[model samples]
Target: MRGNTLSYGTRYLGRIQGIALLVGGAMLVGGCARLRPTADGELLGDDAVVAHARLLQMADTRAMDTLLVRQALAASTPSVRAAAALAIGQVSGRTLNHLARSLLADGDSAVAANAAYSLGLLRDTASVPALTGALGGRQSVAVEAAWALGQIGAPSRAAIEDALSKAALPEPVLASLLLATAKLRPVPVAQLIPFLRHSNAEIRWSAAYPVSRTLAPAGVRAMLDAARDESAPVRALAARALGRSATGDSLAAEALGALDTLARDSSAHVRINAVRSLASYGSAATTAVVALTADRDANVRIATAQILGTVLPPQRSVWISAWNADTAFMYRRSLLVSAVRAGAMLPALSPASADGWASHADWRYRAAAAEAGGSARSSSALLENALPHVGDADGRVRLAAYTAFATYADSSRFAWRNQILVPALNDPDFYVRATVLQALGSRASAAETPGILASYQRALADSLNDARIAAVRYLAAAWKRDSTNFPDSVRAMVQALKPSDDPLVRAEALESSIFSSWIAAPPGRRRLDWYQRKVRSVLLPALAGRPLSATIQTERGAMTVELFSIDAPLTVDNFASLARAGYYRNVQFHRVVPNFVAQDGDPRGDGNGGPGYAIRDELNRRRYGRGAVGMALSGPDTGGSQYFITHSPQPHLDGGYTVFGRILDGFEVLDALVQGDRILQVRIR
Candidate 1:
């Protein structure tokens, strides 16, 4: 809601001043009013109206709406033309892109603004010239164009620099340009130095982050100046920014002094930020954060407890003592996460007991004890002790205990998860059943196919997405079982998957589809070209023209992804081509090791699925961060269509895998790939 967002509204026909007349004219029936020509001679009609409305949704047939929208741009009314500009940019196709670029050259100022907005989604360098030209034009168009440059990212670097030189652009838009530029690596650090003095709080705040990250000298000076600003929020923000800066002890000392002064400020919101910011300071900031743990506000105290666990985490003996003493379940949970992150509390976590928390009559305390016991899943003794809770009286605590067992379960070490987890596949709750499906899958590494098969049979009959997804996960891991009714079961789920609400379901379904596609392809041809077709016809083309409100659909669900094609064209192109070729159809997910990746696209139905070719690894700093769509490779540059969606940020893969795409939806589905899910089919719209 920053930058030029406000300008998009409040212009043209809509304003508060017109509200009174509209209220008085509420009975009037101009709702279906005729198109009235402005100074232009063109007339907008029903087709134009429909084309204009297309802007509201980014979807499968957006390409079909593109040409009609281009003509709508020629409409006489500013609103219709503006809507057309918006709709034109909402699609992703070469033809639609051409039309969207043309709108940037439109005669109307509003049309130019819409064109700039569309170009942001296009992410095409070719549109930079037109967008930059719009920025130098009259009124709000400049602000919109600045925003478009930020959306398009690196391609608009020069244009962004040129806009910065102009004093005409608003402070917020200029601030946005600086933030976006910082992410580009080779940013204009020298130029951004001036924004520190701007009257706008947002501009200063945005500038503060990149400067601290870049460790720019001018930025350090600017933050210091901001720390002394008359506004407490700005002072607090500046102080917090310095705490995490590379400025080291010098900055920490300065920030600590500022924080102490602001801790006494009247604003609870500022104090909350201060509590979190203490993470940037090691020992020096601990006292301040801990002091706030007893603050009058409940939320503040909660935040303080959370921060204390992070900043000055407890020792193992102290952690055990706190658990033995503290009555607040939430506080103890925070302490566990804190102690775990601090890396010294696992010994205390070992040897959990069954009725351990029944010592207290409170059901919540019992549940908390069970839940906490599950957190020690890495230790078999703890997981073993917590296993009985999978059938506990409280559905939620039972589900949590199961997840913990599955999360840390190792197949080679013991057959305990096999004995306890497989039977829980039919657990009543959607979550418990899902965990059981995965825990059973993990036991398959121990080669218990019979147990795996039984779990899949029970879960396949369940309708919860996690159950359906788990069946697919298990089937992929056990290809021998997948060759039977499994494929049909997987496809049924795809056909039944609700794609709009969840992202994990879609990724799993799509990944499962990749497995299915590999399975269905004619032998020997299941290589790079197969993936190319899918990316072109389905994936890339979906986001080619405009920024879609809801652009891509997968077997699991639908999502809106901001395409990074401008930065990773080959990677994006590969995804789109694979989607178009049905490369994801009927393919086994191929790889589903816990806490690693829910992978697919191997025709061999092993970890060997590929497009029969390789792509040079194009790893920037972004790497295989969690939920990233990355190209899986055999060696340095052996990447193809074989890819993985990691569950957590993996900086280890940064220089290895080529990160080309990311999940905009359906993360839960990837998490649900409980060792046996099979994809029915994969489609992109």
Candidate 2:
């Protein structure tokens, strides 16, 4: 999922102020202001500038030096203090929470906001009292503190309620607080109901988001009213809330009627959410759901296909008809996977048809055929359908076949299971090998098979980093299953890789090794001199005055995006450098979820590949709105070449992902993209 470590390089900077800029016939609204320089009129000296850059570099490298952070926090300059507060949060250990909390009352709003954000990042439960007290402070600080409380989750609910009970909160603060409520479990639906009717569209939409997340029956009436709100986002979330809350309740019929109307709403985003909600009514909503399968929007059709099996019976004629009629591979694949998930007999595909698909020239169809085996009625049928393709010429097909076998087949009943699986350890594809290793490790028979053991032994020396990581996981799983019988060689291998050059491999090895006590230790700082130099020489200079923009050329059209270089310089530099090096050329948008995101930058065409190295996340104050570009990560600090652009406002993703850019033009082009769409090239400006 991650990549190997490499020596660092320097980059440059740019900043955006809250202003509207006309770019190529489109209006681009930059919501965030540029990071302020020192208050003094005197230009920052060279040493001072480098020192400031070093603080950011320390955060980038996750250097956990409390003393340095404390010194920076005590700086007279608001910018330095603000940077230190952000760094403390980015480093993300609880060691500096006290010092960070002390900055909550700083004279500068930016300093206080950054401190609250850091406290939230640390997830320090002890800071709740202090954070809650700031909920009524400056509007900006209150918003950040509320978000931080939400990040801390349910423990801060009473404090949030206490603030809400107060006389009058500003619209911005109230809207932020309402959105934060979405993150807490057992959402305060009663408190949220009144806000749904708020005159301000922003507040109404914010209230709708929490109700959508909780789906509490009590909010059904208010949500129903919100469904007709002028704002598409409010209507979209309200539709979801109605479907989830109205199920098996007195409001079911009324809710169903509202969903049907909303399903035809002008906004594709509203329609996508409405279609998903319609699934809750079962057969009662089938006709409406089936009608959407023919919708002109590919994403809407994809959404309809996804839930068709849930709404319609397994024997419905519509499944086969849709599969045959839909020409798009993504839609057809969605239909098959949905049908299989619902345990459909899949009578649509006869033996000859199945065989034809398996032999199809396109590997995607072949992979789908392999995946369809999960729908088989019996073990024999499952094995008969999936086992033959384990050695398919296409690695994706082989990967799909192994995945099906792993999920459905009773490998223990088949005497030749090891024969089929052991050889896959040598599969040229690292992902396939990793999947096979996972499959083998999961089976009880792996411990008794000499070939399987030998395969694990050989995988330790594999060239690919992911395969070696998988081998370490297999060793850990094997050890856990039968520690008494665990081989010394495997244990030794795990120990030997603990200091691996690859950060992921080392992290994995450290996690798997017998030295469990050492796992709690903080991660060692990787302050590579080359990386620091690059941050100072390349990244810092690039951010001077001018803003950076990237034009991504896809078959649909070209979309120009303005980079948030000042807020997320590291991420922007990585993307720009990668673009210049041709890493994204010809790469497919491997993942596209309706009304959510279109993700790309994976070389393997699967969602798993990266640029062969990982980059540190530069999480900033940027919010995810329509056309926002953010990094994709499997977990914290694992971001690499992959990134995605939001199709609509996704409030839940705020503060969770590194958002580095926003679309400046070609919104229509973004809306037109679908799965497997190719990036023709990326031009940096």
Q: What is the C-alpha lDDT of each candidate?
A: 0.51, 0.71
TM-scores of all candidate predictions against the true structure: 0.57, 0.87
Q: How well does candidate 1 score on lDDT at residue 279?
A: 61
- Cα RMSD to native, each candidate? 16.4, 8.0
Over 350-394, each residue of candidate 1 has an lDDT whose tens digit, in order, gives 445443453335544544445555544256445544565666776
> Which of the numbered candidates is closest to the native, going by highest lDDT?
2
Which stretches of model 2 miss by more than 4 angstroms? 1-42, 76-78, 244-246, 315-317, 341-355, 375-381, 409-422, 443-464, 487-499, 513-529, 536-543
Candidate 2's residue-wise lDDT over 1-685, tens digit each? 1211110111111100011111111111222233433324323344334445666657666656676677666655455567778888888857889887888898889889998988887888899999988987998888889888988888888988777677588888887788888778888999888877778989888878778776567777777887899999888877777774455578898889999999899988888889988987888898888888888888888888878877877665656776765778788777877776666645434456544666788887777778877555566666766777787898888887877766664545345456666678778777777777777677433254344445545655544355666665676666667777656764554454334455565566566545363454454344434444554544444445555689999999999998886677778878988999999999998777777788888776766576656677778777888899988765566677888888888876777678999998999899889888999999988
lDDT of 2 at 415: 55
Tell me the TM-score of model 1: 0.57
Question: Each model's number of backbone clashes?
Answer: 62, 9
User: Model 1 scores what on Cα lDDT?
Assistant: 0.51
